[model samples]
Target: MTIHRMLARLAALAALALFAQPAFAAECLLGAPGTTQRVEVSDTGRAMTVHVPGGVDRIRNLPLVFLLHGSGGTGAAMLESSGLAATSDHHGFLLVAPDAGIPVERGFVWNIPGVPTITGEIPTEDDADDVAFLAGTIDWLAERGCIDPDRVYATGLSGGGRMTSWLGCVAADRFAAIAPVVGLRAGNPLPDDPQRPDPATCTPSRAMPVYAFAGADDTVNPVAGGGAGYWQYPMDAALARWAEIDGCREEPETVAVSDTIEERRYARCDGQARVVGRVVAGRGHEWVADNEAMWMFFWRYRH
Candidate 1:
């Protein structure tokens, strides 16, 4: 072969090797189960801990659940407290707990302020655009082959619960089902008058299933009450309104889950959606142990 031709061939082979090396390296990196990694989810440089379980290469068409922590809590704490990871692992699903992005000395709150009964507003200043961040997180995970776009779900406790309601009202299309524990409606009393940035205005474009839970005796997000510092009215009103929107039948099927938990299911609604209200007996403002029941109920429905 001529020296010039040999040189040209060698150059081409080197270029091919260089190009193939990176692809082969990437494949090697993706060969294992997705590892737990921290990702910056917001522009403020706040990071969220994500557990991919197995690396991206091992995941395909996987369902993901966003677990929100309550007031004065962290994503890690909420995940640990909720015992959701175990459930996710058992069910072959991905679990993600995003930090509230609010820095609290001990933990964090959902950015909701003011007493429930009072005619006061829950300050939303620290209420960063969590909805956008969540959407981005979903997209990011999807790119990693770690999330199933059609099976995304959200659930939270207390303030997190309230946030879930907000998501249902605002980003309804993003979630197949939502489970809010100890949270109230997005905007109570339908917000007297419609406004531009109102959550009630963003009702689901399509029917979305919701499973709500609260301790009947929950003094924090009470079940029935209307007074200064009471927020239960809005919660009750929201559930009823959602029922109407979903066209749920008036009477709910009441059943007992356990001595401490009684369930009221409103099913066969518009779009075949349903809401199961789990009234915890004597429970306080907390994520009751019956979460497994709620999780089971949540897994049954999808978009």
Candidate 2:
């Protein structure tokens, strides 16, 4: 062969070798099961801790869950407190806990629409685009063959829960289901239409299944919507709006989860959409059986 032709062939082979490398090679490598690894999520240098269960790669169409932290929270805190990583180990799904971009009180915070963050006491434009960052994270994992596109789920605490609700509003088509704990806030009613409620930021392209939990005695976000502090929707109003969006039956089935917790399941919905409201009686603003209940709720639906 001519020297020029040989050089061209060698260059082509080198290019092919480079293309064979995984785009997320630094992030997607399998680590010890249940061990957390922090990796970059996007071009902006955002990062999250991903936990893979044992034998995750062996399973087909594995489910993935995004666990978000509340205001003044971090990914490490969520991993330590929520016990979601343990759940992932038991269920053989991938778990990712992302750190919010906005910093507050020595921790991070999410940019929930219309909600006053810990960093900003007053409502204002969001400092970071968390929605886009999470969407990019999901796509990145999908590209790396780590997550099932049809079975993605999201759940979170207060500010993070509000962020989860925002996902249900704008990113309905991307997730199978969502469960927000102690954080259900609907938008104010539209002008000249008290009967119709408008959410803070919703552009739902599909019917999203939701299972929300709230503390009846939550002084921070009282279910009655009349407590002091910033104005927000009550739990019932938020559930009603979700039921309307999902086309669920008017009445809900009431079941007592515990002596203190009541579960209201909204049934007979379109596109397999349903909403379950778990009101923890006498409890304050905190999580209630969040890990188990949300897993059960999320497993029932798929994108």
Q: Top model by TM-score, which number?
A: 2
Give all candidates' CA lDDT scores.
0.68, 0.77
lDDT (tens digit, per residue) of candidate 1 on 136-219: 877776665656778898899877887787777767778888888887454443344321123445467777788888877777
Model 1 weakest lDDT span, ten residues long: 23-32
Per-residue lDDT tens digits of candidate 2, residues 1-303? 999999999999999999999674234554676578887866768889888786554534569888889888898788778888778888888888999878787889877655567654644464777888898988888776667888999888877777788788888878889888877644444544433357544657888898988888888767766453333557777888888778887698899977988988888888988888888887887766467667878888996
Clash pairs, candidate 2, are: none
Residue-pair clashes per candidate, as listed?
16, 0
After superposition on all C-alphas, the RMSD of every candidate to the true structure, in Å, is: 6.3, 5.5
Instruction: Tell me how far the alpha carbon of residue 273 in candidate 1 is from the true structure, in angstroms, after superposition.
Output: 0.9
